[model samples]
Target: MLRRLALTAVVSLAVLSAAAPGAAAASGPLPLPSPLPLTLPLPLPQGEDDARTRLTVTVSEAGDPSAEGIFELECAPVGGDHPAAEPACDRLAELADEGTDPFAPVPRGAMCTQQFGGPATARITGTWRARHIDAVFSRADGCEISRWNNLRPVLPGVR
Candidate 1:
């Protein structure tokens, strides 16, 4: 009787352990890829002798890459004695004009260029922002951009 009881307990434990993982996985939606944060230092407008101002730029892809995905850019000033205290956050529709479906994954090395300042010739920076900048491939539902990890002190130099 003792031997039979021990064998039954062991078999029950094995089955429960094997089924636990699958049951948990099916209980909820799959996880999504983590967001990426990129920090950039904006140079003081030319001729201004003030110290450089730090602007943190975070890029996050909304739930799947669709024409309706909300791509947000947030700029916050760090350190330095600047009057710009309000952090600017802007949300633009991803591929608004292309009419492309959003469910598709963003192409590898997808390039996006944003220009600052007024009309006429301005400083043109190449490869300013690119999707999958880290070359990480993720098949999750959506992407997000936040200051969760990439925070650092501002340094003197052009980013």
Candidate 2:
């Protein structure tokens, strides 16, 4: 069921793209998203700074001062300032393809408890795949902890 929904979404996007002005007619297979090069040059004046994945991370632990850092991730060649840039880019790309939102809030009715997994709290803010992302994650509950772990590569010192 989820697979079908994803396929439908992709197909709809293709159709909408084809309908755009000056768009070439649809060919055999719907054009797949071309992998972005490690360095993207948006010389068309999109009015943005460098076209790299730039991010900031802030983590706080109970009874400890907050730790903060930054990372720049590039996907194609998988080179950036991220410690695990290669794997991180691969994981991030996979999630993006699966339509996962890095900043998605916990699902409603999740089986979460008030138990504290740890005293870790983090805020991540950045540009990913041309979109701005600003999110906060905490280990105050099972669901939030799971979400924080999922983005471990991007958020160091959260454990």
Candidate 3:
């Protein structure tokens, strides 16, 4: 029968394996990857930090361009036309130190409260930490409200 043939083959394989346990090792050792070299960052040039953290923020209500307000922000030395430049820069620096990306959007399929915040929206464009950033923000829902609140002065005070 087919069952007998399968059982005989299984027993044969078991006997062969038990008879030569070291046969597998005779193929030789496997090649291992070499360890990578460690690298350290060099010091930043003078004025480099100041040059890397500049942004333009534009806020509007209900998608109305007429109501939009635009402002420039420069960190490091913290000079700009923003109403709360120092506070905004300080908050942004705190985020960077904590390894948080303020411009990240809400994750898909995330559970959030159904409450609506408002129709206010904002756009931030420019460079931060030497990387280009162009992010849009809105207080349209609970998740968005939390995101906006976390940025504080960087986005603008809105309820």
- Scored by TM-score, the top model is 3
Candidates in order have lDDT scores of 0.28, 0.65, 0.79
Off by over 4 Å in 3: 1-50, 62-68
Each model's number of backbone clashes?
3, 0, 0
Candidate 1 lDDT at 11 equals: 100
Residue 26 lDDT in candidate 3: 83
Which scores greater on TM-score, model 1 or model 3?
3
Give the Cα RMSD of candidate 2: 17.3
Model 3, 8-69: lDDT tens digits are: 99999999988675665786676654422222342345656745788999998845454368
State which candidate, 1 or 2, has the greater lDDT. 2
How far is 63's C-alpha from truth in model 2 (Å)? 10
**Candidate 3: clashing pairs of residues:** none
In lDDT terms, which candidate is top?
A: 3
Model 3: how far residue 120 lies from native, Å: 0.5
**Tens digit of lDDT per residue, candidate 1, span 8-31?**
999999999999899988887656
lDDT of 3: 0.79
Predicted structure 2: lDDT: 0.65
Which pairs of residues collide in model 2? Answer: none
TM-score of decoy 1? 0.23
Residue 57 local lDDT, model 2:
57
